[model samples]
Target: MTDLLLNHRVEGSASAPPLLLGPSLGTSYALWDAVAPELSIGHRVVRWDLPGHGGSAADLIGPGASVGDLAGLVLRLADSLGVARFAYAGVSLGGAVGLHLAVHHPDRVASLAVICSSAHFNGAKPWQERAALVRAEGLAGLAEGANSRWFTAGFTVQRLVQDHREADPEAYAACCDALAAFDLRDRLTEISAPTLLIAGREDPATPPVHLREIADAVPGAALLELPGASHLAPVQCPEAVLTALRTHFDGAAPRGMEVRREVLGDTHVDRAQARQTPFTARFQDFISRYAWGEIWTDPTLSRRERSMITLTALVAHGHYDELAMHVRAARRNGLTPEEIGAVLLQTAVYCGVPAANSAFATAQRVLAEEED
Candidate 1:
């Protein structure tokens, strides 16, 4: 069932660390149905439809609502649910909102994951024309444009039925307004939360160059570009996204050299440890070899640098699930809250105020948890 007031669905325990899922522009919470099951294993999942998008009240931001206002609505929804702090994940416009929350309302977020979003949507005239068309007609008027940029032709052919072609017109127009007014290239370094940035390699809407700028600007962000995915990578390649999330989250715990030694290096191995449950054995192998050996051992980038790059990419592309995991990893990698803030400030120009504002709020929430 849905929460009538907040326009959200709650699945899993209230006591668990809340995971707030934000939908992309023009879409509803149904976008998260596939991934929510995987995430619900450990966290309470709260998926919300932004105002004017799904079951929420139909008040558009009028003509002046900012991305920060959208973010504030999310915070209000969480407060309504008694969620003091939560890990946030979002896609597209939702990702922008998550970044604002991290940068400005850091105390409310525990981690951030952003997907297929951009800090700045660029200044192309064609995009503006399309937005005008959507405003004058409806989302249907922009469906072709949205589909071309959002999905690979092959994927769209196969999965067209699942896409949000029937989404609300007013919601789509409001989101276009949010994107149009967003600019945060000068404020990338102000965000202090750890962030993970996930991108679809084939995403034409927010290309690799945008992600590169984000990676370069955010202090402790990491970037993971998934091949064979389009703008909606979370839906197109949920397995890879799940793997990355699991690795980042589990990697946040403090592991002594002794634990590392026992697992990977030469150290005493107890016979009883060998007889542990199959799940435990699999987890050990996953962590030691996949997480540590493959990711942690990569010499191309230091963990600290990776953290910075990841946060920037998240701010750029707006991948909120990975953003949260990276925020937690930033703490493990020794990044301070102030450094995160600096990154958000630096990225303000390239990404935009809406994206940066969300990044800042998410950072604040994650950093506050670290203090607690």
Candidate 2:
């Protein structure tokens, strides 16, 4: 391991919770320029440049490096800053480092957010080829095409492109070697940190499906997909990325909103938010913080079990409208239609036939809508 420290910029009050932001390959911490200041309002935000990418030493890592090596450097940097545990967010290769840390060093990561990154990076053959090309011809060619890979067709961040062009070729190649060797797909289920994933719908490099794969494996993980974004989401859609990060790493209400969106789905939650009034706002906040955040987020009960209990309670009270909504949630929690029917059938014996009858009708309608 290299003893040289990574170059970093710290923001916000030192007393606040520490948040470490990592950059993607070819770009520096400057990639977070649009969003870091706002994040620093409530967090001790530390943005770091990758070795050879910005102000960090090019020799910090050699050609045979791995994502674990990058994560080690980040842990060392955090240790130097007296940050024992922190909320971490990263883009692309930087995101891979976050994944490695969450899997191998869970005690050091309080929470994790992976933006436009994947667990395996498509099996590494492509990264190996890119590493070879960069080693031989340098970053100019890649920088020329950076706009295409990192953003949508007519939306380029000049500073980021220039950072790509100016990156140290040997160090960049070493990063590529790390990417070529990185694969955390099998270890995703082992993550214990509260996790969030943001994906650029337009990103061809590591698309939304990549984020979805991680969300599927990590228990209670949440995902947000940006419509106009590509690989460098924070640069391309700062407001959207900032909002997601805030909700993921902030107070109990924000945490509740994230879990609400995850379990009920975005469309349902968005509609609820839109319909909230001044009189209802407090109630909404209470539900988010108390019911969704504190209750639903409790890991002691699997979401599937919660769905079962919620379904039974709703039926017992003859809350068919709420039952319909939870029917969809039960499906999302991995309950088969037959299993849902079984749950309702059991409820009939205790909740009474009339109540179960209404619930079965509501559930049937909801399940049919899902099939369509």
Candidate 3:
């Protein structure tokens, strides 16, 4: 049993793939309670209270504390729990942490799901002013402002009053500092994991436009906009969020190699396992399910056809890490150099010549290595 420190909770099947949950600033793991039951049906959900919030140590604070710090903590937590690789889902501050993890430590993340967060929280003057005010007077000074931006009118008057009334003042203030400093706009393209971006249609804080920006920035990211919700969409509209998550993970097939072996035959599964190191092991389940199960099993397309489609999609979207993995999978699925060239040529017509050109270069590298 891993010692419960820093206000984190572990629940669901031990054998299942792990899901690291990052809560919004000023909120506890309780923020995820409404949705955890739904997610736990297929995942071993691990929820963390960001430092200075909820059950975590209050000592964790200041400019030293960052989104990268949070990502590192989650990676450490997963390691403690024997989870080499896992899916990540985060809300607001948590979402920023997920983005950082995907960009800086791609091997540790299998997939990323971000809710109601933006690459940059606010522009220079406004955010700095808010941070200064929070630091001076604490969260109460920011409460009215936060509430108005975070919830709908009815939700603000009713739901938020109950929730916000209990938040610790110091913790909330520290979170304001964290948000003020958070910025990842220029680095969004560096992330390699398959990503899901969910946003509230009515969320004044992060809005649908922010989600669209993230979708456009991150390669191979899918976006979902929820109706009649606010920044706290995980609580206000848990069903919609859960349903979309279930559908996405189900469609992606992010299962373990052992599970894949049971379903996909010994030879294919064994070859994949042989390639795994400690770092790559973290991504095996994602590769098995998404690469093998979901994409590979679609009867609508042959294996060769699916390989062609996947390679083209990864390349066109600029998901270079995934593109490399699929290029290898393409060969395993029996795609010859000629067939791979044909797919790249076809992609040039639909996905701009430059994108196809870049993909061709990547494909050539993979093919040469395989030949060697």
Top-TM-score candidate index = 2
Which portions of model 2 miss their true places by more than 4 Å? Answer: 254-372
TM accuracy, model 3: 0.64
Q: Best lDDT goes to which candidate?
A: 2
Ranking by TM-score: 2, 1, 3
Q: Candidate 1 has what TM-score?
A: 0.65
lDDT (Cα atoms) of all candidates against the true structure: 0.71, 0.92, 0.76
- Model 3, position 46, has a per-residue lDDT of 94
lDDT by residue (tens digit), candidate 1, 165-198 = 6655555566667777776666767666677778
Give the 10-residue window scoring lowest on summed lDDT in candidate 3: 156-165
Query: Which of the two candidates, 1 or 3, achieves a greater TM-score against the reference?
Result: 1
lDDT of 2 at 255: 76
TM-score (all chains, Cα) for each model: 0.65, 0.69, 0.64
lDDT of 2 at 81: 95
> CA lDDT of 255 in candidate 1?
45
Q: How far in Å is the alpha carbon of 56 misplaced in model 2?
A: 0.6
